[model samples]
Target: MNLYQVAKTVVYGALSPIYRFDVHGTEDFPKEGGVLVCSNHIHALDPPVVGILAPRPVHFMAKEELFNAPILKTLIPKLNAFPVKRGMSDREAMRKAIQLLKDGNVVGLFPEGTRSKDGVLKEGLAGAGFFALRGDAVVIPTAIVGPYKPFKRLKVIYGKPMDMTPFREQRASADVVTAAIMAEIQKLLDAHK
Candidate 1:
């Protein structure tokens, strides 16, 4: 495990009860090899919950500004977290994610591109779809519910993996395809609610 991941695991474990994490559908995660994990963005807390409870380590994208603090700069990269520019496509970030997939590691994505304002799943951007198609990796759909009241139980559901082969050679309308993926995320969230 990466050093930052180790630290994150330790910290999250200590705080798990405070957050009341309750995870489900973990069995849906592949036992081995690389996979693309896409999930709904409900809150900033979502990534920690998913990363901590997941059967495998998941690398995710975070806004670049979050790493500006000196401590975070050192910690974030080690935790498998990378920076992405908010308003523009960060090609370098995408390459890093793809490289991780090539190295047989799970890369987590928030296809909606940003957190949901009202905790409802929104339309996803095309960035995630393009990565899945290019990497030809299994896409694991996921959803996170609740950061509700104080110490309320948070639910995280991992759906089945999606094969991108059929859409591989298709056109580059990543946004269009991402909408389909986001729909699955919404369904999972609804089921758990």
Candidate 2:
């Protein structure tokens, strides 16, 4: 197995019994091909929880600073994370994610572009839509509801895949597509939370 699979197995073994995350909608995840798993980021645990629970490996875009931190420098990459410069247009990182998706891999990121200061969901930036369009990947709008106390059964729901073809054909703006994706995520939060 690859590093991602092995690490996921080990992490799942350790975290499942402790966290016991209430994961939903695994079936919505496509069994193959390129996919963009966009979600609302709330906590530090958000990415790991979704990564471990996802049926497929998710290579997430992490803040560039994390890669230079003591142990995270070595460990984060093994978890299938790549450094992404935040608060600016980082062309290098964008190209990397687009290439990864084009090569038929799953790429996960937050539409808000950072953790929510409050637990409430916020407006999504255009980055997710940009990736969806450039990679020609299906977008999975996911939601994680949590204040994330230990032993709390937090919920993570993966909604249906959003095909970007309509947006592409219509030449829809990235902002419009991202708004729709965020709306879907909000709907999931409304239903489950």
TM-score (all chains, Cα) for each model? 0.90, 0.93
**Residue lDDT tens for model 2, 1-193:** 8777888888888877777589899987999999999889998878888899899999998889999999999988888899888889999999999999999999998899778978788989988888989997999999998868778788999999999999999998889999999999999999998
Model 1 regions more than 4 Å off: 169-172
Give all candidates' CA lDDT scores.
0.81, 0.89
Q: For candidate 1, what is the TM-score?
A: 0.90
Error of 1 at 69 (Å): 2.4
Number of the top-ranking candidate, with lDDT as the measure: 2
